[model samples]
Target: MKNGKSPGSDNIPVEIVKVGRHRVIELLRIAFNKCLEEQTIPEIWNCAIVILLHKKEGTGEKAGSDHVRKTNEWLRHQSKVTDVIKRVARLKWEWVGHMARKTDTWSKRLLEWRPWGEKRPRGRPQMRWDDDIRQIAGTRWLQVAQSRDEWRSLKEAYTQVVETG
Candidate 1:
């Protein structure tokens, strides 16, 4: 974008990410940037509240502001975004921050967490790997690893440990 000239019209750049998610990420990025530019946290917070309300719909009017206000009023003792329950994956503070408020609530938290699968502990941050687990995750490598498992064989456990060592 810095340089105006393209190689040619036919040279369309490949999209680095899936279109649907890429659009969402771009929307989020813009929202976060705007929030930062304007310095409004509550604006972002209100947007998230609206999203949460939409995510969880109840019997009737609870789907909208009547019950929402009741819930919000009861929940007003909170100061930060992370205080709310996070069962809903769509409850994205980063998007709210970017689009409405202009600041990321969990900027530090996002940077700190690594992509571990589903179950994450409440507080503790994950280490890169406990040992050299990454050293052999490839298909060919897994076969070697499986065969190397001494636990599979009924032969002397003591002998296997020494051999592995």
Candidate 2:
């Protein structure tokens, strides 16, 4: 793993990590098992990056939002993008519970606590992380997460519901 090009949170290159697969497996098993025993994964793992491509029309011109939406609709009607998105969203939902429980940072606190006095412009309200979770998992997600087993079991099905609907 260490010799490879990719780097993870520990900053150890993959080339270094690949030196001893057994050692890596043992270390990961121990770390992951500890998290499982504690019923909470660490906050560091609960993140993802979203990149949007500039979609083009049939004529090769850049499409506006409306045209992009139509293209996406057609693509979705023809293939499995919807299912793939649901899977990604399910994984994301699995992290929200763990993230909600963390309080060691100001940014995390702001996201989870959602303190008052912030006003939005007169147009669309900014989408908060909590709002996305709620739309997928429902208003009682925090309560649901209290039972780790139930939360894990429902994550897949719930995200599918949110995605398809």
lDDT (CA) per prediction: 0.36, 0.64
- Candidate 1 lowest-lDDT run of ten: 81-90
Best by lDDT: 2
For all predicted structures, in order, the TM-scores are 0.18, 0.41
Error of 2 at 123 (Å): 2.7
lDDT of 2 by residue, 18-83 (tens): 677667766776676566446577887777444576644554335533343456657445432234
Per-model C-alpha RMSD: 22.8, 13.7
Off by over 4 Å in 1: 1-19, 42-44, 47-165
The sequence of per-residue lDDT tens digits that candidate 1 reaches over residues 24-75 is: 5666556655655465554435543222434344535644443333454243
lDDT score for residue 75 of model 1: 36
Off by over 4 Å in 2: 1-83, 103-108
